[model samples]
Target: MAVDSYDFWLFDLDGTLVDAEWSYTRDVFDRVGDRLGRPFSDREAEVLWHGLGGARDDQLREWNIPPTEFWPVFHAEEDPQLRAEATYLHDDAAELIRSLHARDRPVGLVTHCQAFLTGPVLEHLDIRDWFDTVVCCTEELGWKPDPAPVRHAIRELGVEGEGTGVLAGDGANDVGAAWNAGLDSIHVERHDPAFRGQCVLGDYRITTFRDLGQ
Candidate 1:
């Protein structure tokens, strides 16, 4: 049997590649609040973070944090420092990227992370050269589980045909993104110790990218 049905690979940055611990942003949020003259407790920071990848408007309204000021404050004071902190990568990730590169396969990075943040993280990890393209999409292009960024990666990679691509990552958003883009998904949930079963949303599930068969 064929190991994988793809010549083009779309990857998610945070959990799937480097362990950005994307879900944790309390420290940064706290800093943002401090800079704005409002101190955020851990509780308030958690509420703001859910807004980061989720409903911005609702978060703004509920927290009374102004949308116009929140991001700028966050980016200027918190993002760079957090980017440095999130630079660690999984052990087998680079091996998989290299294996694909050896075969001359095309790879694209589709991340919901900000360009400034993602750019430095990729550079710091030294694996940025492996990907053919990188789309650091934010609210403008839509986030994962919404399908917009997946489609954006697909279009930018310019790979021929539908089945030629597969997106591999650690979260449901990756699987959902692939499904939304009419491609397959491989869930690499090894790093997620809390995860204990197969993902129906994922076309395939593996402990690591090395398990992707030839």
Candidate 2:
């Protein structure tokens, strides 16, 4: 596949570009758990972290805690750490972005994460300039697996022609969004078989951005 042929490339933020090593939910969960006298175990934290799935509010609900009560404490202590840790981007992410830019291919970012979370990572990496557009979860635009956000991004970037755009992401929702929008999709996975039964759905499945060339 010649990446240069694509007029626009859309990317997913969490797990695709940045590894979620220092998740805010994990920090808040642990802190809140300790404070509430219900500390989470390593196993429990792992499950809760994955279940959070980029939505902070969902995690709070799972714990049966009110955001008004919990978030202030979390904001004071854990939010800063989350911001600091998000500073690290994936090893190949910057290189991939640079390569696409060098090819004169316009890059856009589509993330389920809110602007508050996405903004700092883009700023910290100093690669915000590389993206031509960023479509995040706002009041008007809903989450991924819903084609509306993806379509909005494609329309916003003004990319036309069949297969002229690609949506690159790591989850099933990402694949579904691309297919729904009538665009080619490249699935970037950390390990194989996470979407094994559904492998036939994606146009391409790769472990790294480097594989896009092949």
Candidate 3:
């Protein structure tokens, strides 16, 4: 199917459309490590920040860090305003989103980013209105790859399940969630497959939104 053929669209925020500066990412990890009394090398920080190694909990386990102990400190160390200032949108993503918004298409955001940070980033970027619905993954709604959050966004958009819908993201979890919800998936490969240690298959794979002829 063509990109414009979808009845509605859903996207992942952090890596797919926008990303934080490396300095900010590094600082966050530094603080996390300080709090945990465990120092993370630059490579380890990069992998965890971009989820390059796949599931974060699994990576944490491999590093011998208790996920239960790591997450709270990680979230606590992330300052919303600082993060928002450091975030930037991909040009291709911006063009595609603006085009979709101009056409009055239904677009939603489903992200692992918490509500507090998501709000600030959207506001700072002045693109909050681009999305008709924003679904921040939570314990209650469930995370991506589980389909609950994507389904929740679909419900919020008031779109029918039978209509062709597509979800795009830069992670395996996004593709999994789309497939689980019976939607086509777009894998936006923001990082090299070799660096990720695996290729995330999707209905469509591209390096950028331009590959879809946005």
lDDT of 2 by residue, 1-214 (tens): 7677577799887778875664655776678677766776664565443322324456667767675766555445455436646556777777788888787787888887667667777777777887888999555887666788888887777775535788988776787788887878988876445423234257888888888772
Candidates arranged by lDDT, highest first: 3, 1, 2
Every model's Cα RMSD, please?
4.4, 4.4, 1.1
TM-score of each: 0.74, 0.75, 0.96
> Any runs in candidate 1 off by more than 4 Å, and if so which?
1-4, 21-26, 33-73, 160-163, 190-200
Which pairs clash in model 1?
none
Candidate 3, residue 75: CA error in Å? 0.8
lDDT tens digits by residue: candidate 3, 1-214: 4567887899999999999999999999998999999999998998888777777889999999999999999999999999999999999999888888777779999999999999999999999988989999988989779999999999999996657799999998899999999999999998878877888899999998988854
Local accuracy by lDDT, each model:
0.71, 0.70, 0.91
Q: What is the lDDT of residue 54 in candidate 1?
A: 36
List the candidate 2 regions with Cα displacement exceeding 4 Å.
22-25, 32-81, 160-163, 191-201
Q: For residue 113, what is the lDDT in candidate 3?
A: 96
**Top-scoring candidate (lDDT):** 3
Query: Which one is best on TM-score?
Result: 3
Model 1: which ten-residue window has the lowest total lDDT?
191-200
Ranked candidates, highest TM-score first: 3, 2, 1
Cα error of candidate 3 at position 156, Å: 0.2
